[model samples]
Target: MSRHDLQPKADQPHVVRATVGWDRPLQTFFAQVFFRTEDEPDEGEALIWLGTEPGEMLTPEAVIAVVAPHVEMPPDLAERLNAEMRQTTGMKDGRHQAAAKRSLFGSIH
Candidate 1:
């Protein structure tokens, strides 16, 4: 079933749908964010605010902050998500192995 079908009703507080978004840059990698929601989706409204402050970077930590009030996440899920984001960035830059090595054992001298 589609995720939209999983949207929670007022009495079903535990049910949620994951809504994802990304920051658009004029010329660089897009920063992603996601939040789980129980609120009924608005049929014809612009749900996300795309016009962020100039030079604002919506990192995963920022996404968690915005989402904290909306839903509960496992303690490690956010950390995992942030790690995955880092991996994705490295992959996109074609430096996954290098970055992983640096993260694990410091840069090569």
Candidate 2:
């Protein structure tokens, strides 16, 4: 899965979208993550703004790296996903091979 929000509010975000899926053709697992915010357009109305970073293909490790620094994550989960982003960042092709790596999430398949 690939996802990117039009704009992301790292300071005070109101929404977070994250998902994981297997890319059969790529022979790997992929992940997507995005952050957004809600605004009041009128009285008693919440307008969701989808303005954020240009979504791009990121490995599960990369997703966690981006998120961990900006938000408070569960201790166990954060430690796990953030395992190798430091070393693997910007290396998409190599990341795909790490599909068998560990994560807090599991495949439904």
Candidate 3:
């Protein structure tokens, strides 16, 4: 991950999550901030917002704006999420896509 990535603390499970990418089940390229729980991890999450529409790229302000009404959002959370979106989608800066890739693609050579 890049230094600019908005990653949640990995040490513990969090109720809120922010992600930027194509969702397999949702089948779209999006940036999202939502809440979920351990009991029903699959579909329990309450979406604050889906930051980008299909065929649209992410905008950091949108992701940050989505979280604002939900709680007293931390400054770092907003900043990190913005940075991650910028890094991943390259809407601002150019695409540094290596960090954003979900997994290795193709087959063994």
For this target, which candidate reaches the highest lDDT against the unseen true structure?
3
lDDT per residue (tens digit) for residues 1-109 in model 2: 2322222335645535443333332333344443343443222122322212223423445544554444454445434434433434444434433443322123222
Model 1: per-residue Cα lDDT over 10-51, one tens digit each? 543433433322322211112222333444433322233332
Candidate 3 runs further than 4 Å off: 1-43, 47-49, 55-57, 86-109
Clash counts for all predictions? 0, 5, 0
**Higher-scoring candidate on TM-score, 2 or 3:** 3
**Clashing residue pairs, backbone N/CA/C < 3 A, model 1:** none
Residue 66 lDDT in candidate 3: 49
- Model 1 residue runs over 4 Å out of place are 1-16, 20-46, 49-58, 93-109
Candidate 3 lDDT by residue in tens digits, 8-84: 44442443555544332222335555456676575446454462333343444554454444434456664654554
lDDT (0 to 1) per candidate: 0.37, 0.37, 0.42
Per-model TM against the reference: 0.38, 0.27, 0.34
Weakest lDDT window of 10 consecutive positions for candidate 2 = 42-51
Candidate 2 at residue 13, lDDT? 55
Global lDDT for candidate 3? 0.42
